[model samples]
Target: FFWGFLAGFLEIVPYVGTTIGGILPVFYMLMVSDTLWQPLAVIGLYILVQQIEGNIISPNIMGPSIKINPMFIILGLFVGGIVWGISGMILALPILAVSKEIFRSFDATEPLSYLMENGLARKKDVFLERFDHEKHRILRLFFEKREEGE
Candidate 1:
């Protein structure tokens, strides 16, 4: 009951959603249970609840709210795990969600909008611009050499 209740509470979080919440109860049982059979039963219950949540509850409740691709989630978790360990991994989803929202808001269609879009687009533009400038410099050098020879 406690595990289920906590799972309900953790459902409030965005992407990580119920997964971390579901794991907690089983881990607690593993640590605290006196009898082998009881811990196994508790673990079994957690697995059952997880299946139900994954199939029925999560689809209905969280749905597109956390509809980011699994690859991105893995990337976030990997970076978060590297930086902040388990807590970082746990918090990564919300952080990524907020960042994505910010990026979307910045993607307006204007010069100012271009400036505002905090993303690789702006960076790529800058790089490309710089490359063009360098190419122009090289062309100028070639022309100067030709003129000198003439």
Candidate 2:
């Protein structure tokens, strides 16, 4: 039940997060039980609950709050899993969502926020960001060299 609740709570994250959440209890049950049916039953319950959350609960609750496209959520989940393993997968969605909200404020990252919605990132956003960072580094170094000369 706790695992089911956790899975539902993390419904906003794409594919892998929920799966991770759901599997924990099933594994626990499998280890403790002598019979296979109990674990299979837990898996079924998790699946049913997942369907409800996906079709009903999340659309009403998380839709207005996060506003991220499903594709990016999956991408973030995968990236987080790769970098941080299970903990990362669990955390990635909220981290990505918060970052996206922050990114929405800057004109430079506005396109990035849009890209989160559809995964269709424009080259302009990437190039401009890289260019700006490089430009700043060059300018800072130039000023530092001039100050040293003086």
Q: Compared with the true structure, what per-residue lDDT tens digits does model 1 show for residues 14-63? A: 45766687667767877888777876787677678778867998777864
lDDT of each: 0.65, 0.75
Q: Return the lDDT, model 2, position 22.
A: 83
Clash count in backbone of candidate 2: 0
Per-prediction backbone clash count: 0, 0
**Any idea what lDDT model 1 has?**
0.65
Q: What TM-score, over all chains together, does every model reach?
A: 0.45, 0.48
The most accurate candidate by lDDT is 2
Q: Which stretches of candidate 2 lie over 4 Å from their true place?
A: 1-47, 118-150
Give the best candidate by TM-score. 2
